[model samples]
Target: MTLSFDGTVIVPAADPDDGERTAEALVPHLTPTSSVIIVNVIEKAGGAPDKASMEQREKHAEDIFERTRRPLQSTDAALETDILYGTDIVERIFAEAQDRTADAVVFAPREGNRLAELLTGDVARRLVKEASVPVVALPQRDV
Candidate 1:
């Protein structure tokens, strides 16, 4: 069977490099018709941040998307950006993938300490296992 992907590339603001790495991984697999949506979840574990407002967060996410788009643009793929807010990061990501009719979800696996994983709840792992679409995590490589 011929394989194809209309994908969403999921990246967190804390690790924006993941988006760039994911774009690199997708280069060989993507067709000209492939649609790539780059998503960054502005994760707020609590209601209404006292420091940064939603507008500020959105502008920051927009700037991150602006930089992230260049590499994906090199492949001649249709690219879009999505910024979401919530504590349920994985759920929001899955929602976007389904809404976009994505055939796959691409990501760069993040290596975090046990404490951080416990606190943040291993989103990459959960997304890989639970997503309806195929989750393609770019292999971890040394810089």
Candidate 2:
């Protein structure tokens, strides 16, 4: 089945590198009518002190958006950036998708080992398995 990127897509990116790579992978799939919402979720500590200050985290999110926008600039797709806050990253992403009425949640899975994924609760796996909307893991190009 051919996947169409005609409507709004929610893209959750963890970092600058992931954002850039995901954008690159998604570029080929998007059409002139596609709307891309590239998001960075600032994980809260759930009442505890955050790992980084809000200002710093916001700056980092901006960096992610900047890099992500590079490859996407070549496409005619509408691009937007967002910063979200939540204790659970996957939940925040899903909430955004629902709020935006996104057609799909698209991303390029970040590289990690089994142990790391297990320790971190494997967000990529959860995103795919527990999605209310379609989740597309675009294949990453070799560096």
Compare the candidates by TM-score and give the number of the best one: 2
TM-score of each predicted structure versus truth: 0.79, 0.95
lDDT of 2 by residue, 81-129 (tens): 9999999999999999999999999999988999999998999999999
Among all windows of 10 consecutive residues in model 1, the one with the lowest summed lDDT is 6-15
lDDT of 1 at 4: 49
Question: Model 1, range 69-141, lDDT digits (tens) per residue?
Answer: 7667778678778788767788888887777777777776766798998897788878877887777776644
lDDT for 104 (candidate 1): 71
lDDT for model 2, please: 0.93
